[model samples]
Target: MQNPATTAFVSDFAELPATASHGPLRIEYRWVNEAAGNAPIAVFLHEGLGSVAMWRDWPQALCERLGMRGLVYSRPGYGLSTPREHAVKWPVDFMTAQARDILPALFGVLDIDMQARKRMWVIGHSDGGSIALLYAALHPDALAGAVVIAPHIFVEDLSVESIAQTKALYETTDLRSKLSRYHSDVDSAFYGWNDIWLNAAFREWRIVDELAAIKQALLAVQGHDDNYGTMAQIDTIGERVPHAQLVKLDACGHSPHRDAPDALNEAIAAFISRQRR
Candidate 1:
C-alpha cells in the first residue's frame, strides 16, 4: 500500500451537477476501464470513512478481472464532492436517503442508459454496502445484482465500540491526519459519520425488513474476525433474502478488498458469472 500522506489521493476526477433536497451540489467521480464500452457496469460504493482514493487500485483490478466498466465516486461529506455543515447532523435515515435520493440522482445526472441500467451491478462495503442493499430493495429491477461486503443491516454493540475507539484514535493519534489526504473537508467526512453512529438515537437503526423486498441476485460477504461487525450481519441477510449467497472468509477483517482481495474477487466473479448463466 502506498503511503497516503505522500501519494496523491485522486489524480484525475470529473464533477457532475446533482441536486439534493438541501440544494444544488457537485459530485466528484471517476470511471474505470472506460474502454470496456459495451461491457457490464460495476458501481462501487465506499465504506463510511472511505473515498474514491481510499479504494486505491482495487476497482480497476476487479473491473479488469470481470471485464466490466466501473464507476466510483465520493458521496457528500466525504472525499472532494461536498462537505457537510459543521453544525448539521445526519438523520437516522441518512443511508436510506443516500440510496433513495442520491444514487438515482447520480445515475440520472450521468445519463446512464436503460440498457446499462439493466446490466448494472453494485459493489459496496460497510456503510456503502447498507446503502446498496437499500437501493436494491427500493428499485428491484434497476440492477442485475449486488455484492455487499461487511454490511450493517442492524446496529451492533461491536460496531459502536469499534467506532467509538476510532473516534478516540482520530482525536489522539494521527488517524485524522492520514484520513485528511482522502477528503477535502476532513472534519465533515469524519464527524458526519462518527457522530451519527455514536448517537443514542441511531442504536435502533436497521434495514432487516427491507431485505425481503430485494429481488436481484445478491452476494453477502463477511469476515470472521471483523472488529466492527460479526457474522450475524451477513447471516441475517441470508435469513431475510433466502436466495442471497453468503461467503464467510476466515483470517479476514472488515475490509475484504484490502484484507483478502484475490479471494474476494474470485467469489464476486463466480457469483456474477452464475447470475449471467
Candidate 2:
C-alpha cells in the first residue's frame, strides 16, 4: 500500500485549512471529495486522540464500499487541529460542546448541506461516538444514521480505572513518546481527553436520556474484552434509544475500528446502505 504521505489522493487544499470558533475554543478540520457521485456523505469522527491522519485508510475503504462522499477530520486539540492552550480539564458538557458548537462550524466551513443531502451518516469511535450521539439527539432529522464504536454514554468505574492505567503508561512507558510523534501537540490531545475523563465533575457525566431524543437509525458496537469500558456501555444505548441496534465483537478492545477493521468497516457500510434502501 502506498504511504498516505504519498498516496495519490485527488490533491486539494488538505486538512485544517478551515478555521472556526466554539466559544473560546478554536476548531480545525479537513474535507475530501471522493469521485463517488451523489452517495451519502460519510463523515468520520475520530476518538479523543484521533486526527485526520490517524484514521488512515479506513475512511477511504468505507466510502469506496458505499460509493459515498466523505469527510474526515480532527477535533480541537487532536491531530492537526488546534491544541488546548491551558491545563484545564474538559468541560462536563464536552460532548454538547462538540455537537452544538464544533460540528455545525465544521459543516459550515466545508459547506456540507445537512438539509439537502440524501443522507448524512456519521461513524464515530470512542469520544467521537458520544459527540455523534449528541448531534443526532439535538438534530434528529439532520442525520439518517450513525455507527458508534466503543461509545461511552455513562461514566463507569471500569472506564476510570482503565484511563488510570493509560496515564501510568504515559508516565512510565514510551506510549506518550510514540504518540507524540504522531500528534503535533500530543500533550494537548492526551490531557484534553484523559484529564477530563479523570476529573471529579465528569464522574456523573451521563447522556443516556439525551440519546433517546435521537430518532434516527443507530448502531452501537462494542468489544467484550474492551479494557476502557464494559459491555454495559453499548447495551445501555439500546435500552435508552429503542431504535438502536447493538453489535458486540469478542476479543476486541477499545478501538474496534483498529482491532477489527474489516468487520467494523463492513458493518458500517451495510448499516448505512441498509438505511438508504
Candidate 3:
C-alpha cells in the first residue's frame, strides 16, 4: 500500500508543541484545525511502525468530513519525535504509557484540558486502536467518541506470524527504506514496536477487559479477510463495552482505511455524526 502524505499536515514551524513523556523521551506533534471554531478535535494515533508521515492525509480527510480539528504526530522514536534508549524496550505497559503519559502530554502541549475543552473524537487504526481504547478507558468523561479500525483486543497467533513476515520484508525488501522517509529514528521505532509484539510475554496481553470502563460511544471496525487480526477483535469490543458498535467489512484487510478508504470514511463520518447527538 502507498503511504499517505502527512508532512503537509504538520505545523511547519512550531515550538515545544505537544510532548508525550514516554520514558526519557518526549514526543513532538502538530496540532491541526485549532481554529475550526468549536469543531470536534480528532486525536489520531498511528499503527505500530507508523509515524505521522506514514499516516499521510487520512487525518485531513477525517477532520474535513467531521468538521473537526486534528492532531497528528510521531510517538517517541518515530518521525521527528525524540528517540529513546535502544536497550530499553517498550515496557509491558506500553499501551499504558501511551494512555496515561503520552495522551495527556499531547493535550497539555496543545493547551487542551479535556475536562474544560470540547470533548474530541479518536480515530485509531491497528495498534492505535488499542491505544484509543486505553485512552477512552482512562478518560471516559473526556471523549466525544472513538472509531477503532482493525484493533487487537487480545494477541493472536496470526498477528505474530504476520509481524514476523513483515520483519522479514523490512530486512530483505525496501520496507525500511520506505519507512525511513516517514520516521527520523526509523530503526528505533521499528524495532521497538516489532520486538514488543513478537515478545513471548505479549501473547497473553488483552485490553478488552479493561476497556469496559469506557463510557464513550465506540465504533469498532475490522475486515473479514484481514491478514493480521480477525473480525472477532471488533466483536470483542462490542461485547465488552457498553454502547459499542461493530462493522466487519468483507474482502478487507488489516488496513481498511487504506484498502477501502471510501467505505471506511463513509462509515466513520456517519458514526461520528451520530455520536455528536
Candidate 4:
C-alpha cells in the first residue's frame, strides 16, 4: 500500500475567507489514493493539536484496508494552514462554525460535488471528532457515515483537568518545541484549542441535543484509559442517536488510532461494511 504520509509534504492549499471578519484562511490539505477513482472518500479530521503530519500513516493504512480514497487536512490555525491571530480567542461555538461553514466551503473549493458528498465518510479524532459529529448533524443527508474517536458531546471535569494540565505542560515543558515541528505557528495551534477548552463558559459546551439531528450510520469509539473524556461521552451519543454504535477499547488512552490501530481499523471496517449492506 502506498504511504500517504510521504505525500503529506506536498500539500494542496485553498483560501477560505473567514465567516467572521478574521480574513481568509489558507487551508493545507492532501489527498490519499486519489488514483482510486470512483472509490468512496474518507475525510480525516485531526485532533486539537494535530496536523496532517501528526496523522503519520494511519489514514493511508485505513484507506488501503477499506479500499477507499482519503482526504486529510490541517484546519486553520494548525499545521501549515493560516495561523490564528494571537489576539483573537476562539468562541465556544468554534467547532460548530467549522462544521457549518468551513467544511462546506472547503468541499466547494475542492469541487466535492453532490455525488461525491453522497459518498463521503468522516473519520475524526478528539476535537475533530466533535466537529465531525456537528457536521453530520448539520447535514444529515450529506455523509454516508462517521466514526468519532474520543469525541466530546458535553464538558466534563476530567476533560478540563487534562486540558489545564496540558496547558501547563505547553508553557513549562518542551512540548511546545516538539509540537513546533508540525505547525508553522505552534502557539496558534496549542493555545487556540487550550484556551477555549479551559474557559469557564466552555464547561457548558454540549452537543447532545444537536446529535439527535444526525441520521446517518454513526460509530463512537473511545479508549478505556482515555484521560480527556470518560465513557459518558459515547454513552450520551448512543442515548441521543439510538442507532449509533459504540466501541470501547481497553488499555488505550485518548488516541485510539494510535493506541489500538488494528482494533480501531477492524471496528471501523466492520461498521462501514454493515452500512454498505
Instruction: Judge candidate 2 against the unseen true structure and give its global Cα lDDT, from 0 to 1.
Output: 0.77
Sort by lDDT, top down from the best: 4, 1, 3, 2
Flag regions of model 1 displaced more than 4 Å. 1-20
TM-score between candidate 1 and the true structure: 0.95
lDDT of 1 by residue, 70-133 (tens): 9998888888777898999999999999899888888888888877887999999999999999
Estimate the Cα RMSD of every predicted model relative to the unseen true structure.
2.7, 3.7, 3.6, 3.2
Q: TM-score of model 4 relative to the true fold?
A: 0.95
The TM-scores, one per candidate, come to: 0.95, 0.89, 0.90, 0.95
Summed over model 1, clashes come to 0
Reference-based lDDT, residue 113, model 3:
79
lDDT of model 2, residue 7? 26
User: Candidate 3: lDDT of 100?
Assistant: 79
Q: Summarize candidate 4's per-residue lDDT along 129-227 as a digit string, tens digits.
A: 999999999998888999999999889999999999999998899999888878888888899999999899999989889998999999999999999
Q: What is the lDDT of candidate 4?
A: 0.90
Reference-based TM-score, model 2: 0.89
What are the lDDT figures for the candidates, one per model?
0.90, 0.77, 0.79, 0.90
Question: Candidate 2 on 23-129: residue-level lDDT in tens?
Answer: 34444444555687666787888987777777777788778887877888777777655677766567899888788877776676566786633278888999899
lDDT of 3 by residue, 1-277 (tens): 2223324444432234444443344565666656676766788988987877777777777788778888886777777677656887887678877877777766776678765434788788899999999988887788888889998889989999999999999999999887887876678888999999999999878987788798878889999889889767887788888589888887789888788888888998888778767
Error of 2 at 235 (Å): 1.2
Mark the 10 consecutive residues where model 3 has the least summed lDDT. Answer: 1-10
